[model samples]
Target: MTASQDTIGQICKLLEPFNSTGKVLTPDTEISTDLNIDSVAVMDFVMEVEDHFDIEIPLNVVSETHSINDLAMVVDARTKKA
Candidate 1:
């Protein structure tokens, strides 16, 4: 798989447990809106992402990120930099 695809898959795995709304997790799934995740939950999820990916995602990027694709892109870029 391409980097973006791989990243998306990994993110999907991490986000699955948070899918309490039973929304279909996809690359375009909006973290807060679609999944009904609050701001605090989003931050918690970001911390999980950091631990799983071994990359520190900046708060600025976290604030700007909305969709799963956006988060995956950040992860993909960070992994590449490593």
Candidate 2:
């Protein structure tokens, strides 16, 4: 799989715990709306993602991020190899 795809998949795995509703996670799944993750929980989930990816996601980025795809794209951009 491509790097973006891999990042998306990894994010899906990381997001499983926050998915209290047991929803099927996809790149398009809205973290807050679909999974019903609250603001505090989203921040916690962001911390987990940061730890797993070893890259810091800025507050601005987090605010802009809605779906898993948005986060994966940010991660892919941050971790891209030159």
Candidate 3:
């Protein structure tokens, strides 16, 4: 799979326990609204993503990420750089 696809899959796995809707997560899924992720949860999720991907995502960039695809793009770019 492509890096973006892999990132999305890993992100979906990280979000599974916190996603109350039990809906399948996709790249288009909104991180906050669709996933019902609160601020604290977002931070926790971000940390997990950082650790798993071995990259530090800036808080400003995190705030700008609306959907899973956006996050995946950032991860994909960072991973490529590393």
Which predicted model would earn the best TM-score? 1
Query: Which one is best on lDDT?
Result: 1
Question: What are the models' TM-scores?
Answer: 0.93, 0.91, 0.89
Off by over 4 Å in 1: 1-3
Give the worst 10-residue stretch by lDDT in candidate 3: 1-10
Q: Write the per-residue lDDT of candidate 2 for residues 1-82, one digit (tens) a residue.
A: 2338899999999999889898898888988889999998999999999899899898788999999999898888887741
lDDT of 1 by residue, 27-54 (tens): 8888999999989889999999999999
Superposed on all Cα atoms, model 1 deviates from the true structure by an RMSD in Å of 2.1
Q: Which ten-residue region of model 1 has the weakest summed lDDT?
A: 1-10
Please list the C-alpha lDDT of all candidates, in the order they appear.
0.89, 0.88, 0.85
TM-score between candidate 3 and the true structure: 0.89
Distance from true location, Cα of 23 in model 3, Å: 1.7
For model 2, what is the C-alpha lDDT against the true structure? 0.88
